[model samples]
Target: MAMIKTYRRDDDGVLHYREAWSEKSGVRTHMGAVGTKGRTRFHSTRSRTWPDKPTATEFLDNFTEESAADGYFPVPDDDHGWLVLQCWTFTADLSHPDDQRLFEHGQDALDEHLGWRGVGHYDGNDLGGKPPAGYDLDGTVMNLFCKVVDTGLGVKVVRSFARAFHLTPYHVIATREPGDDNDYVLAWSPRKRDKDFDLFRL
Candidate 1:
């Protein structure tokens, strides 16, 4: 519990006061150094509490928040009726009653993004490819990637990299049994249904 202060050496060789934050209120207050001599001056960032932990979904939608802070998004689009501008991250307003639309439109935007070019793309790019420009890698990108696919495809893509992407089973978790794992309960298996299984590789 030491006091916070900024000290600058004066021409007289004595350290002079510059700034300090009191224990109460915790706001940064600056001191005037005008006319007073100091070799250099610097201001420390104000101390802040660790941000609240967000649910997985909240963390993923950060791109939208960042975009909104930059003066777009939360704007209304003409055809789509939401502020649907393209950015390194999406800026979707979840104010509507229909939340699933976020997933639907978000996927459409991500699909058209240059990063996912070519129809042949698969697990690796979705999991390992460069994130949208200017954005650092974090769960946000993966979450958005997860939403890019329609439900059937999304379930499959999410499976291939369950370990690599560090994804959990989520809704599928409670239903899964110890000996088996399948995102789609009806997905065909050779041993389970011999005649329906494809014998040759496509």
Candidate 2:
């Protein structure tokens, strides 16, 4: 079972908890801060001495709930998956007058302008290579793929991209991966399929 263990710092008597769990690779632990005498909430990772053990435990419960709501889970012991910081899925309407530039200029123009590489639909070619037939940017609905900066900057990046391209981000989600740091791959597509290389889910 996953648990949060509390500890008091020897130097300052500050209380903190180490949230850890068993994963396929090994145990994964994350630290939480329980502030000093007057501060009851665990705001961020900072040194704080709790008055007693019960206070630390109470804060642990709150931290666990917040972590869960943020889509953080114990690294699975079996399926080798990488954590997804944030994913934004949206379709650009090529018919829109303002968005018609995406269809007129094609993906090559976008790639050159935004420094984005093209990922083929049939084959996993995502290095600015040519996409497979019928997957070009000539369709009425074009998919936009933007590399997420990080969890903290994901939403801002997505929204900025959407505004620049006159598109809308319909879906956004964050995930935790247990496998390699480079395992999470990003790709754009108009049609959704199970075999698509970019379709990763927890």
What is every candidate's alpha-carbon RMSD to the true fold? Answer: 23.6, 16.1
**Each prediction's TM-score versus the true structure:** 0.16, 0.23
lDDT, residue 196, candidate 1: 30
> In model 1, where do residues sit more than 4 Å from their true spots?
1-146, 168-202
lDDT of 1 by residue, 1-202 (tens): 2222232335764323333233332323333232222232322323344245443234324434553454322211111110111112122233332323434454454333311211111212121222232334222222332222122333333333333333322212001111223221323221333233111112
Pairs that collide, model 2: 14-48, 14-49, 82-177, 83-176, 83-177
The model with the greatest lDDT is 2
Per-candidate clashes come to 2, 5
Q: How does each model score on lDDT?
A: 0.27, 0.34
- Candidate 2 lDDT over 99-167, as tens digits, reads 454446434443332222111111111112222334333323223333321222333333334455554
Error of 2 at 132 (Å): 25
